[model samples]
Target chain A: MSDVKTTALVWISPSTWPACVDAARERAPDDHVVLLHVGDDRIAAEAHRAYAGLLGRGHGPERDPGSRLEALSGVAGADLLEKAAHRLGRPCELLDRHGRPQEEVIRAAADADLLICARDGDPERPGPHSLGPESRFVVDHAPCPVLLVWPHRT
Target chain B: MNSLAAEIVSVGLLLGVLAFAVARPRGLPEAVAAIPAAGLVVVLGAVSPADAWEQTHTLLPVVGFLAAILVLAQLCDDDGLFDAAGDLVARFCGGRPVRLLGGVFGVAAVTTAVLSLDATVVLLTPVVFVTASRVGAHPRPHVYACTHLANSASLLLPVSNLTNLLAFTASGLTFTRFAVLMALPWLAAIAVEYVVLRRFFAADLAVGAHPPKEAEQRTVPTFTLVVLGLTLLAFAVTSLIGIEPLWAAFAGTAVLAARALRRRRTTLPALWRAASPLFCLFVLALGIVVKAVVDNGLDTGISRILPGGESLTTLLAIAAVAALLANLINNLPAILALLPVVAPAGPGPVLAALIGVNLGPNLTYVGSLATLLWRRVLHEHDSAPSLGQFTRLGLLTVPATLIASTVALWGTLQL
Candidate 1:
């Protein structure tokens, strides 16, 4: 063997985090694992729009609940990443990002050898419906090879 | 311009303005659409310059009151009134989701009735969302209560909704008399909403968990509560003193803004922005556009369709038509279109139309500006209910509340 380990990027979401983590450990045992969690800021943007629409854009940022929500989401995202790292119980790089979750995952996977994620849609189905829109987009657009795992045994 | 061409152009311009207002293409301010449309109407000779000026003059007080209330609501939010209410609700619910739902309903009703529906959506929705998450309760039911009551519970006071404010000006009733007339209807509508929401979201409310220990330590802001109480008292006093109620709202906003400023909680620029000159201008411009439409003979068509009388059947017909029209063209314009026609028949029809415009928005997202704002709030909190789900709930609640409240209004009229 050349003794060069593969780099795997594992995408973590609140719903299917365990499956991705387990896949990283089982299939890429000796690989360098990078755990990625993306905080969706669309909600924050939506809140800002609501504020601007009703309250006007002149109000200071301190009065906006959108920025407050974004901060809270960041804290929650970090906490989740920590919990995910703890569950992996092995050395891994934790990458926390914000924006569209699928786009962030695809961007983070650019330097990795493999992208690992879980099917987040209908568990009972056995077709494309099994993947959510974000995961579907990630699978279709990822720069690296992808390992898609079922969240639970069907 | 010939009368026929003027009428066609005026209607076309009005439609374009409403489309831009509703779609808000690329998030432009509503005034961006309305001001231009208003100018076009005047310039096209669809409305006389004198008529447009008259419309602006008539709308000044309503717009002034609206600005004051927006400021008051923002300062109150800055003072932590909504957060305190949410915290109190979470603390008292004792980890039961159903109880939390009821608590949210009560608080939302009061907030909408007192501060207007926009406050409940823009300020209280996020607080309730955070509170639900902290308590480990599913947030759907609680947050839905905020939006639903923002529309239905707004039946109580003239100041509760912008539509009510318009109707109040045209209805020629004292503030106390308006509240007294709408009191029973408000109670009935709220009751129907509570019952329907509880049953609709029963599964979500079936489970609950205790709030995190840290959440329990949050303190309520007492000074804000006292000021709010005194503000409510001032509304009644100002009404009795025979002055525009905007004075009371201005006083409340001034006191709260001063306290917020002294405490370094808010700034003057922030206060000015919260007052939202763009939105005020949108309202004024909208008034001019609507005047152009009415002047072009839209009211004659509306008058033919709207039944004229104060009888129970007539009230129901007026309310039903108002509700349908409200859903078709957002409530603000709907009320504007219907008011001139209904106001001539007296307070009974005007109040009935009020009930319709206020309660009708529960049926669709586009039914009211407050509903649209509430939808945005829900989307940001990651708890957006689906269109189908929202409509199903509306179908269950709107008809029941409408009939119950209209009957109640007719009963009050009898008294």
Candidate 2:
């Protein structure tokens, strides 16, 4: 175990980018921040191929699906984390994990003192007040205390 | 323990497992939660070992059929058929947003009717979203259409849904007769859906169409298209010959799998991964659980409440109840519980129940597995529709479609 502490683990998605930024802003200057984004490789590959097909292509690139999705999510995460770190005037680490969003988030939260996430609202609900399946699971099972940001106002 | 207490304990245990399966926290696969519950039933003597074995026998065909359809859908996806269809839909719109909505409805209905609702949710949703994005149209209307039409439009053919298959088997109607009876209801349901969806999504539907960029354009596979057409033809032919439809589905799956395998487009392991045996296990376990409930006198009350005539009033009443039950529990379990009750009333009521099970799930998030799967798909893609939004839409559309389709079913039966 390293003597240095990683205080907060923030789960970021394209939808939760703003909430993640807000969490980063709230962190103490000495607090170590690790921002994580989880993406489904299969889904990303499907979307990629579907996008390529829509553009008159037969298939997507023949690269490894897992790495491609990881890279894509990594880039998106790094971009947002970099912006957050620059705003906080400190360095932040971007962690990209591949799998179901809730599972990966729960696994990553084991090492952190605090987990920060936004309620990913369910589409069936009228407003952003309701919690999504992933967010609900994270709040319930994350190893550390969770700070859930409701970014969508009533 | 006394036999009575044991039975009660077993039933309670099974329901708990089912609730977990339905809630599916942490995204546990349905099969993973269900199979163990099934094992519990046998261990508790809620169902005898022999009865459990018999249940497996009954489930094998349904599993095989669903697995085959799933494989076919995945392979078709790998072949870029859905994307090609999506492109065609965009082209057909010719840059109009409303037309794009219409195009999406048509393609989604056909996809749901042919490939099953799950397939539409899995394979077509992303394409719909991407297409909507490309055109700069509101993705909500187009993307939402995939889930709604996937449920409402699936009432048309027996192959369109698992619930429909159950009803078709119970109806004792020939395949052609079943389609004939459902044809009007299917049309009526789709019309009601179109009117409601257009109204609710009116603001979102009004956008300028943008054609697909050069990169998204691809040559559609003419051979695959032909094969799909022939496979559909084979379904009709198999039905006419008194052969089970699963045979045709299996044959079609084999042909498609062979082609995809030969071309090195897909692998055998991919097939296994695509189809979950755990889901089959889940269904079988649910059956045993439902059987335990039914054996404990659930059926007596159900049969009493079931409408007893072929009259339009009776059909409507039965459908209303079925829809209510489906909304309360899921349609799969609802259908399992109520099938015996409805089947006794004749084909008319059986089908009316089918209509309810298929359409009623649109009322809530947990009403059907397909809707849950649709939600998961949207979440994965970073788009979430609020539950209130879904419930509101369901409130508006479900009753209207249910009534319209039931009336249509009555009229068809009269004809």
Best by TM-score: 1
The window of 10 residues in a row where model 1 chain B has the poorest summed lDDT is: B203-212
> How high is each candidate's TM-score?
0.76, 0.70
Q: Report the CAPRI category for model 1.
A: incorrect
Q: Candidate 1, residues B1-415: lDDT per residue as tens digits?
A: 8767777887787667766665555557778888989999899998899989987887888878878888888888887788888888888788777788888988999999988887886788788778776675655567677777888998898888888888998888878889999999999999999999887765445443465566356567788788888888887888898987778888888888898999999999888888878878888888888877786788887887877779999999889988987777677777888888888899999999999988887776355443565466556657553455567888999999999999999999998
What CAPRI grade goes to candidate 2? incorrect
For candidate 2, write residues B1-415 as lDDT tens digits: 4556656765576556555664455656566656777777667676778876875676677777777777888888899999898888878777666898999999999888888876676678777766765554445577667777878888877778777776777678876788889999998989998999887765444324456676768779777777777778887888899898778888878888899899999899887766655566667777777766665566776777875888988888888888987776677777877787778778988999898888887776354443454457557767553455556777999999999999999999887
Candidate 1 regions exceeding 4 Å error are A1-154, B212-216, B367-386
Model 1 pairs whose backbones collide: none
- Please report the candidate that would top DockQ against the real structure: 1
Cα lDDT for residue B319, candidate 1: 90
> Candidate 1 on A104-148: residue-level lDDT in tens?
899999999999998766565667667766788999999999999
CA deviation > 4 Å runs, candidate 2: A1-154, B1-11, B23-28, B48-51, B368-385
In candidate 1, position B386 carries an lDDT of 40
lDDT of 1: 0.79
